[model samples]
Target: MNCHQAYEALQGLIDNSLNKKELVEIKTHVRNCPACKAEYRALKMVAEGLDRMPLYETSPGFNKEVFRRLGLEYKPQRRPAWQSLAMAAGLSLSVFWLTALAAALPTLLMGAKAYKLTQWLHHPELILPSFQSAILKSGLAAYQTLGFAAKVAGWLLKSSALPTQMAVAGLLALVLVFITMRFFRPQTSL
Candidate 1:
């Protein structure tokens, strides 16, 4: 193994996680390479120092006290049953009033404009010109813009090299998506 490979394997060697074959290769490389040997010594010393440090113990209720200091404790509130019932009753009354108003709407409108409503209903053509002209103008404008866009897209699709270009673009997009997914993937242990 080279110095680079030995350095990469140094952590595994220090943690005693390397298999026999890799262990031998890394040990030989580290012994032969002065830089790698020094790096290994420094890492080993740090690991040993960490292992030698004393572990501290916390007193009972320590977590609860910490959470209390941080103001994260949950306090439950109890509300009276009558308050809930009153809210429900208010909501039901409001819904009933709305429904009754909706049911009486046609009758109210008929009383206000019975002649004009009847004329429009009998002769539907009378309603068309007032509403249709504005809608047709807007629809024509939209159709013109959409038609221009469709023509441009059709021209691009008709080009002889478009298939090759699309294939290359698709491959690039797939590669970018794969790289993004790998970069943002959550780390989990087996």
Candidate 2:
């Protein structure tokens, strides 16, 4: 590591929190850079001094006394049983809904497909003209397919089941976003 990196990792080095590679790199940098070596020594001394400092125990009544001095009651708050039960029930209900959604998802998707098919069967004009022409003109095929998909999507969005489908899709999207954020988030430590 360079002097700056070595300097930044000094606390990690003192606490033995660095990996083997980083420890080796910082040690090498600190050995060569006189300024960094001095800084490392100072930090190490301070850490050692702190380790050697005596610990004083507080009396059991310390918290009570402080609260009394502040003219406040020293009460440790306790949550009621019903609040815990309500939270657990809410969590259980959420899981149940998600599970039910998972189970019903295929059926809902099939219904959507059926809607498009029915729309085509009833209103033949809504269906795209043969792609055989589109095939002959390769450049137009993608545009034609996109147009057809957009038409079907518009129809689906206008259907009576639109609200339910949107809600399910929204929930799934939120869950995916949350999962991505939770797993890929940056982690830091002292």
Candidate 3:
């Protein structure tokens, strides 16, 4: 198998998720490709290091202090698994959406540049240049115009992106506030 395939399968092979035949194939690829082997080793070390880390416990009276602040008296409630999951899911979804939107910025800029360059190329005066020097001069002018237009377009696009980024930041902040209120809101009773 090629390095690309080997890299993709590295996780599965390391985790022993693959059958013997597939494992042997991946192992062979790793043996032959030193780069893949080194990458695999680094990833394995990171995974192992994470696995070996110790779990931490909150200090005693943490829950009492939280409930006291919320003025809530402890009455056992059903598991809050859904709340935690919902918070994580909301954060993940927002991040994904924002990332996808941001990723479109470059494509948008390229499209604008291409469209402007086409317009510059097809201008009537530019097409009428008869001599080589005239044509060269026209082409140079078009290049400069294209550069200027692209700069303006880029500035406008960048300005537009600012509001989007701010909105995303505000949304993230609001989510953080809401999560803190729900999770650490002072309990109603002491």
Highest TM-score among the candidates is held by which one?
3
Lowest lDDT sum, 10 consecutive residues, model 1, at 96-105
Q: What is the C-alpha lDDT profile of model 1 across 1-190, one tens digit per residue?
A: 8877887899999999999999989988888889999999999999999987654556656777778899998454556787666556555444433333333244344653643454333344455675765554444444334334334545656643433433433343454445444544444432
Cα lDDT of model 2 by residue, 33-149, tens digit = 999999999999999999876656567678889999999989965778886666566554445444444433444568657545543333333444655433323323332443344
What TM-score do all the candidates reach, one by one? 0.32, 0.31, 0.33
Candidate with more favorable, higher lDDT: 1 or 2:
2
- For all candidates, the clash counts are 0, 0, 9
Per-residue lDDT tens digits of candidate 3, residues 17-109?
Answer: 998888999989889889999999998998899887665566657887789899989654565898877767666544543443343344345
Q: Which parts of model 2 are misplaced by more than 4 Å? A: 60-190
**lDDT score for candidate 2 against the true structure:** 0.61
What CA root-mean-square deviation does each model show from the true structure?
21.7, 18.1, 20.2
Q: Of models 1 and 3, which has the larger TM-score? A: 3
Q: Which ten residues in a row have the lowest lDDT in candidate 3?
A: 97-106
Ranking by TM-score: 3, 1, 2
